[model samples]
Target chain A: AQTVTQSQPEMSVQEAETVTLSCTYDTSESNYYLFWYKQPPSRQMILVIRQEAYKQQNATENRFSVNFQKAAKSFSLKISDSQLGDTAMYFCAFLTTSGTYKYIFGTGTRLKVLA
Target chain B: DVKVTQSSRYLVKRTGEKVFLECVQDMDHENMFWYRQDPGLGLRLIYFSYDVKMKEKGDIPEGYSVSREKKERFSLILESASTNQTSMYLCASSARTGNSNQPQHFGDGTRLSIL
Candidate 1:
């Protein structure tokens, strides 16, 4: 079984600053995928970024990037130049290379971007 | 653009009543998922379907069931609504295989309250 862990329960960052949310997972599968999802006040889950375990390079999507360390089993999300709209609950998820399309998600971290 | 739509944005049900949450995807995605989100608990998968008439149990599927009569529709059923089940329900869909890295697109969650 794969388990994703988000150690930070709540985080706050000033507007225009940068913040990093930490995530770690335990999985036996060598081939897998990691993802970060954001849920805003509207309750729509949006994709932030994703990383493939086989790839050594980290994934970046504009202001959102991931620091993926395969050996350490760590995948952290970084939000650069945070804005008020970035305030939301962030989740880390995992998908194994094999088996049914079942996703394992971590307890979310509530982020507040203060102006 | 890929879109996943949930039947209701807010629902209020009485305890012991039968509850049905409907989800439809227009992207011809083969994989459909139902997840429940509670405060601090993140999103917990309830059930998923890979094809029409094919359903699979997820991490927490004990009190729920699913129906997939068509390729693009997946429904989550709560046999008997309980207060504990009062939470936000999220529906998502994605391509079944090959493009596994493609993120799951989600609908605005339905907030369910059992009174």
Candidate 2:
């Protein structure tokens, strides 16, 4: 069983600043995937970024990027130039390489972007 | 673009009532998932189906059942709704391939209130 952990329950950053959300996971599978998802007030879950365990390089999507340390079992999300729209609940997820398509998610971190 | 739609955005139900949550995906994804989101619990998977008529239990499958009669549709069932089940329910779909690294697409979610 894989378990994702988000130590930070709440995070706040000033507008136009940068913020990082920490995440860690425990999985015995060598091949897997890590993902960052955002949920806004509308209650819509949106994919922020994803990283493949086999790939050593981190994943970056515009202002969202991930710092994936496979050995440490850490995958953190970084949001640059944060805006008010970035205020949301962020969740980290892990997926295995097996045929199943289930995700293990962390408790989530509520991010607030201050103006 | 993948589109996952839930049948309802908000639902109020009575205790011990049978509840059904419907989800439909237009992207022809082979994998569909049902999850519940709670404040400190993150998103816990209830059930998932890899193909039509094939269902699998996730982390928290107790008190929950799922049906997948069609490829694009997945339904979550609560035999007896309880107040503890009052939470946001999320539906998601993902392509079933290891090489693709495809992230799951989610719907806006259904806020289910069981009283």
Candidate 3:
């Protein structure tokens, strides 16, 4: 069984500033994937960024990036140059290559970008 | 662009009523997933189908059943809807052949309310 944990329930960031959302997971599998998903007010789930456990380098997508520490079992999401549109509920997810390919998600962190 | 369309954006049903949530994907994805999202709890997988007529139980499958008659459509069913089942239901699909690391495409989600 794998579990993802998002310790921060709520977070706020000023417009154009940067914000980091913390995430941690417990998994015995060595080959796995970590993902960050965003759910806006419209209730659409969007993929923000993803990082593979084997890849030591962090994943970066435009303003979104991930700080993946495999040894610590931590994968955090960083949103740079945050905008009002970035306000959403962010969730961290994990999926192992083997088995059922089911995703395990964290509780989520509600981010509010203030103008 | 991949499109995952859920049948309803919002639905209201009474207790003990049989509820069916439909999802269709434009892309011929090999995998489809059904998840439920609550206020504090993140997206929890209810069921998933790897191929046509092939179904698997996810993390939380109690009180839920699924059907995959075709490759592009996956249906989630609640035999007896209860108040506890009221939540936002999300549908997602992804290609799982050589690219199992691909991110999932999600639907807008169906807000189900069981009263």
**Model 3 TM-score (2 dp):** 0.97
Candidate 3's displacement at residue A29, Å, is 1.6
Which should have the higher lDDT, number 2 or number 3?
A: 3
- Misplaced by over 4 Å in model 1 are B99-101
lDDT, candidate 2, A1-115, per-residue tens:
7899999999999999999999999999999889999998786889999898999999999999999999999999999999999999999999887755778899999999999
What is the DockQ score of candidate 2, to 2 decimals?
A: 0.69
Q: Which candidate would rank higher by lDDT, 1 or 3?
A: 3
Question: What does the lDDT read for residue A74 in candidate 2?
Answer: 97
lDDT of 2 by residue, B9-111 (tens): 9999999999999999999998899999899999989999988999999889999999999999999999999999999999999986654437899999999
| Residues B1-107 of candidate 3: C-alpha lDDT, one tens digit per residue | 89999999999999999999999999999999999988888888999998899999988999999999999999999999999999999999988867464678899
Poorest 10 consecutive residues of model 2 chain A by lDDT?
A95-104
TM-score for all models, in order of appearance: 0.97, 0.96, 0.97
> Which model, 1 or 2, shows the larger DockQ?
1
Give lDDT for model 1: 0.92
What lDDT score is found at residue B43 in candidate 1? 89
Pairs of colliding residues, candidate 3: none
Name the better of 1 and 2 by lDDT. Answer: 2
Q: What's model 2's TM-score?
A: 0.96
